[model samples]
Structure formats: structure tokens, C-alpha cells
Target: MRINRLIYHEGKVTNPYSVAPTSHFFGSTSQSDPLFWFVYACGPLPHTRGYLLFGSTLLSGWPVSTVHRKEASRFVPSSVRFFSFHYLSSASSFLHPLKMEFKKPATVLNLANIRQALVRMEDTVVFSFIERSQFYESPSVYAPNKYKIPNFSGSFLDWLLLQNEKTHSLVRRYESPDETPFFPDQLEESFLPSLNYPPVLADYADEVNVNDEIRTVYIEKIVPQIAAKRGDQDENIGSTACADVDCLQALSRRVHFGKFVAEAKFQNEMAHYTNLIRNKDIKGIEEAITDSAVEAKILERLIAKGHAYGTDPTLRYSQNPQSKVQPEAIAKIYKEVVIPLTKKVEVEYLLRRLGDDDEAEAQDPQRKTQLMNRLLSNSLW
Candidate 1:
């Protein structure tokens, strides 16, 4: 049967007549909120007549109205079925094409897929480090209030990042689950249509950002080790800052990919992670998730990549190939910083696995049940 019409029922507990025109959009944030409905068409439908169908945004191929659930039930033909709110969002996938297909079971959510993604990101980080090594350690870029631009009081790099975030936000870059902006507070809504990427991580996954710490480590540790020399260059301040942004964004994404890793691990062994989370055993959770052997492999792989990509094949210095950034320094970075931060993210994400929402959803019985159901549905998506 071809279903054409789609009427949304707000399902409010109040009298339908009392529904004065208030907000046009109804996006409920909590599970305990009154359930909504999507009344799909079966056959010929009655006219909306606009009787108490107030405060609703218009829907195409269907009446632009919100009816009481009981009133909505009157049009419930054999084809109509109840779906969770998450399903309502998922259904939007049909209208607005999925931009980031990270929700599928066989695609983005698994450990194997995540590992491949992480490996690719390593290449970006290595290349970025090599690029940054072209410039001297431009201390002016990181110094406070180094470039005095109107209405902004921060480092040159900070100002650049803010402008970059604002520009990217216009095209909806931050809407993608994998992206997290350093200047989150200043980001504006996209001029483009909303792309409802099917949920892959927790609702609060964005909050698990470690960009601040990443920037700190990059300046304090990574730059000093990877830069060409100790002197600051006046000519390369902008170029150096630009390269820093690239490295920071890459590192941020690589580290935060741990969220998906954590989610996949938690789903595979729910009971094990659940008990660990419940016990507040941070050490226990860390040990269970840690694979020292895997870490060693990553370090070895990164050193090899640095040697390959950081050096010119045709060139040699002495008996050894001349490299842009020292291969050992690259290995040392993963061993000291990237791996540890990733583990921190995994542990934090796992610890919040049992929470009601990301911040606090445990005490609410209904929210907990809904959370479990949502996680299962997302895993099966």
C-alpha cells in the first residue's frame, strides 16, 4: 500500500481547545514528556478543518495540524503503527538525506570500522605534524593577545580558530557527529538544512570534547618537539597557526573517536561494562578496556608511517634518511599523549554508560529503560 499522508499528533494531556497558539515546534527533551504520533494515511482522509489544530507547523501531503491522541486514533487505519520518538527522527532520514552514515551496524559503529577510521586519521596527524615542522616555533601565535583584533581578546591562534569555526558552522560542519569545535559557544546555526545524522554515540557525546587539553599539549609538548627550530618566525605566524588548527582538529577527532570505540565495546559486553560503571571502579574499567599489545602496535605503525611520509625517498642525510619530524618523536607522541587521551575518553564515556542521560539519567526509571531501549535500537540501526 502506498501511504501518502503524514499527520503528527502532539498527544498533549490537556484539552485540545485549551491548546493556545504558543510554540510552532514541539521538540520534547525528556522521555516522560507526553508521547507524540505520526498518523500515516491508509485510504481517503477527512479534512483537518483547522478545529483545535493550533500551534502546529504545516506538513506536506498531509494536514498541518496537531490533534489529541484519542482524536488522532479516529483516523487510525490498519496501516498506522506506533513508533518511538527516535524512530520519528530516523524517519526524517528519508526527507533529509543522511550526511554522515555512522549509525549502520555493518558500517560505522563496529570496532573494525572504527579501527580503520582511526588508522586513516593517523595519516592526517602525521602529515599535519610534518607540515607544521616547516615553520619555526612561532611563539607569537600562541602568546596571549598577540594579535589585537577588534572585539576579540585572545591569542592569534584562538582568533583564527573562532573565525574558522564560525565559517564552518555556516555550512553545518559541526552538525556531523565526529566534529567538535573549539569555539562551541560562538558557533551559529547552519544556513543549510538540518542533516539529522542517525545517532551513533551518546546524546551528550559532544560534551566529551578534549580540544582544550589537546591544544595545551600541542603547544606545551608537541610543538617544542616537532618544530623546525626554537626561534619564532614573524613571516610564518599565520601559516603556523593554520597548521596548528589542522593538527588540533585531527588530534581532536582521533582522540574523540574513542567514544564510538567505547560505545561498541559497551554494547558487545553490556553486563561487564554495566557492573564496572555501577561500581564506580575507574581502574577496573580502564584495565578491562586497555589492550597494551594494541597500543604497542599503534606506536610501531605510527613510527613506520612517520618514516615513510616524513622523509623524501630520494634524499638521505648521512646513512639514514632525512625526515621532517623525527620518527621516534612521532612514536613518542602516541605513546605519551594520543593513546593516553584516547583511553581517558574511553573511560569517561564508559563511566557515563550507565547514566540516565550523559550528565545524570540514572535516577529516573523510565529514562533508564528508554536509554537501554534507545541504545539497543541504535545498535540495531
Candidate 2:
């Protein structure tokens, strides 16, 4: 706990003061007394507790600049020195107070702990080097300066490259099958067969319900391709499809502007009819409108009526003499009623075709070409 100086020579005690009794104790000594007394003492006590204690305190008392060299020369070479001075009762008792007053001594580390520490240290050093380089040098020199450390050996760069390569590979693996060419480009044509609507009178017959039949025909012939096109459009639009008008417009342009225009007209007609039914004076009309079967039947009847007017140019003229249908009235009827209905039917048919192809693609493990040739075929140019 304290440093004290004593001098013993050849079993005889020496007291420089000369005023003390011949007892074991000596009077207080000055700074000069220890040096004079130690000269006569045994040649520097080597490898002893007293020698170590004397040497450490002596070296520490000197200026810091001289301490290392002085201590190295005095202490035996490679001799490990363990300081054991206790101001506390036990190690455990000292821990709490030591923790409160100073940083805790780190526990002895094993190989794994050392490895982890080294990794963390390496990361810290790398980040520090990057920060310093960025602070002092031009951005262009950052990479070269970062890799220029003498001991770096490029292992870190190699590890980083390996990690990046692995991440890229994982991303590619999860990518859509269509992206990786699972189906041939020509196979897209075979997925759906195209049919032309002949301009025949039977095709436009009053009894002939071509809406459902047309829908079915389109579905059977063209749905798959539409679905494929839809998937491609979805990719083009990304997840923000609905919100992005520019993207939707681009996709619409790619598909067919005419198709979209027709569909819009059809939707307007359906909405008009829906409004008419809701506002109708007929009792139980609301209930009938709500009924899926009733709505379907009503829609079928309207569609048939609309087809008759659309197909038969001769019958389209007003037969009543008292109530002459004006050209404007006829145009309005077609614009507000017939054109919209036809558009709705066509749009619904196109959508159904797309849906069927989507379902097929989902079920089929082998990715068939999931893009529409129509996009390429129906170019505006």
C-alpha cells in the first residue's frame, strides 16, 4: 500500500541520523538518505519481490520519457511482471466500485472471440480509412487509396465481391420464369388462335346472341394472349400501375388505343343503364337490380336489342309516322346506348380472355410465352 526505504548491510542496520537508540527502527530519512543507504546495500536484488517493487516504483518516479528504457534495462528480459496491490478485500468486492470508477477489465478472449474482435476491428479500420480518405482526397482516388494500405492484401475486397455475387445470384433465382426464357417466343401465338368476325347478316341476326358467343369465342381464341400481354404490361407498369397515368398510357398505347376507347364507351353505357334502373318507377326494381340473375337477364335483353339496332341498318329507321326519330336522336341513341353497350361487351370479353390466360399460366408449371403478339401486331405505325 505504501513505499518505504530500508537499508541493511551485512546483518547490521545503518542510521544516518546518528541520534537513534540501537533499536531495530531508525529515525526519519531524507531523500538523500535512501540513495546513500542503498549504495551499501546488496547489489540490486534481482528477481525478488523487493527488487521488483523497488524497480517499478523507481522507474515510475522518473520522467515518462525515460521510463521504458530504464525499466527494460533493470528488469530481467522477458520476465512477466504481475502487480498485486489490494485496496479492497476481494476481487468480487472490488468489481462494482472499479466498474463505477473506471472501465471494466475485458475478460480473456478465446479464438472465436479473438476472430470476432479482429473482424470488428477490421471493419472499424476500413470505415475509418474510408472516412479519412474521403475527407482528404478527391472522390476519384478513394477506391485506389482505400485499397492501397500495405497490409490490406485485398481479402476484404474479395469477400465483398463474393457477397455481392451471391446476392445477385439469389435475386436472379427468384426472378419470373418468363424473364429467364422458359418458353419460346413463337409459342405465344399458339397459346391463343385468332378468328375474324365475318361481315355476314347471320352473324348479326336478331335471334343470334353474339355477345356471350363473341365473348366465348374471344376467350377461346384470344384470352391467353391478352393475359400474357397483361402480364407484360404489369411488368412495364410495375406495382404502381394504377397510380401512374403515364405508364398506363404507355401500356395502353402498346396494347391498342381503339380497344381502350371501345371499352370506355361500353362502361359508360352500362353505367347509364344502371342509373336508369335505379331511378325507374317500377316497384321492386331495386331488388331486381340487385339480383344477379335478373341483372344478367336484363343485360342479355338489352344486348339483343342493341345488336338489332347495330346490325340492321334498314330496321334502324323509325317506322312511326307520328313520332319521327331525328338524325340527332338516332345518333344520341347509338352514342349513349348502343355504342356503349357494344363497347362494354367487347371490353368484358377482352378482360375475360386476359383472366383465363392468367389462370392458365398460374396452373401451368412450364412457363408458356406470356406476352400478346397483338402488342407487336397492332402497332399504331
The CA lDDT at 136 in model 2 is 17
Query: What overall lDDT goes with each candidate model?
Result: 0.70, 0.26
Q: Which tens-of-lDDT digit does each residue in 1-381 have in candidate 2?
A: 222222221222233332112221223332432332111111222222222122212212311011122332333233322222221112212211111110111110111222233233322322222222212112122123343446443322222333433443344421211111111121222222333322111111222123333223322332222121222232332222122222212222212222322222322233433333335423332222233553344345433433342333555555732212122333343234333443343333333322344345434534322221222122211
Residues 58-175 of candidate 1 have per-residue lDDT tens digits of 2322222344545434544434424322343343322222222454433455565677788889999999999999999888899988788899998999998899999999999899
Residue 232 CA displacement from its true place in model 2, Å: 57
Highest TM-score against the true fold, candidate = 1
Q: Lowest summed-lDDT stretch of 10 residues in model 2?
A: 100-109
Q: RMSD in angstroms, all models?
A: 17.0, 39.6
Report the alpha-carbon TM-score of model 2 versus the true structure. Answer: 0.15
